[model samples]
Target: MSHIVSIQTEIRDPVAIRSACDRLRLPEPVFGEVKLFSSSATGWAVQLPEWRYPVVCVVNAAKLAFDNFGGRWGDPKQLDRFQQIYAVQKATMEARKRGHSVIEQPLEDGSIKLTVNVGGAA
Candidate 1:
């Protein structure tokens, strides 16, 4: 009924993972090399729990894949939330890497806009 979707994220640093968790405020511990969940995954996985089929993370691939047990790849709402937080973290990391300062501003419509400033003349 469910499906597996591999989400290739820009998430490289474990610290970014911690920040994402903190930003979303997950209820339980979703850490370590790998983990599994029954509800909507806040962390990441790519396995369907079953009696007829068994799946597991057997390789060390640096990625964040979440299992969709809701008969879909994932819940749109939850995935959006994850994307929002992940966007900020990823943008910030890239901005800093390019020698720019990243600033996040919350808009009236409840959307965050990232502004990067490369100081030099302006």
Candidate 2:
């Protein structure tokens, strides 16, 4: 009795999606055109373990939409994983792009300490 669920999100970058998948140790994401509500959009497909269908990620003008998905083979935890991995990847990319250094430390509490800076060299 599981049905498709469309989970809206703040994710828009295809590169970030790819990075997220990499963090999960899953297969590379598939990217191309997708059908949106009233039109078609192009983005990537997010695939988690045991999911028969992938969530369609469509980006338009820097906005991302996660189309309705997750019928029977979907785990709600996958969305959490995507957010976590995407954040790390996006943070690292932005920091480096700003000519800064990034350091990620995994805490004993299972959280990550992400530090970014120019190390006062600026």
Candidate 3:
């Protein structure tokens, strides 16, 4: 069995989001941060910081999705998500190094999630 998680916040500044994404690119894939933007019924947006390529990221995102919408645990799905995030994070880093921007669109169901900055010299 698996667990579900939900992420909720209210901060949507395009500049801030872009800056955060840029800063996140400085780290390695295992410790890159990803921001999730969510909106309430009234169109209010929230920014959520998450780890982009970690097992915890996938598990947490699924938890949030499941919490919002009732669902059963699917480990395979979660693992697939982890892989996707990792690949994306790696690609994002490479793109950023080449002076490109990373834009991750939000999901309609409000399950948007990402990774946190890590993999720094620790």
TM-score of 1: 0.51
Clashing pairs in 2: 5-69
**What shift in Å separates residue 77 of candidate 3 from its native position after superposition?**
1.1
TM-score-best of 1 and 2: 2
Cα lDDT tens digits for candidate 1, 5-62: 3434555555554565567664322343453455222333322223111122222354
Estimate, for each residue in 1-122, the C-alpha lDDT of model 3 and write its tens digit: 22333433222323332343344442222223433323212211212233222222222222221111212223345433433444455545555666655555557763434332233211
Error of 3 at 26 (Å): 20
lDDT of 2 at 28: 89
**Which regions in candidate 1 have their CA more than 4 angstroms from the true location?**
1-9, 27-63, 71-74, 97-99, 107-111, 120-122
- Residue 113 of candidate 1: its Cα lDDT? 74
lDDT of 2 by residue, 21-110 (tens): 888888888887755445565677676776655666664555544534544456767766677677778777877888878778888875
Error at 81, model 2, angstroms: 0.6
Q: Assess every candidate by TM-score.
A: 0.51, 0.68, 0.29
Model 3's lDDT to the true fold? 0.34
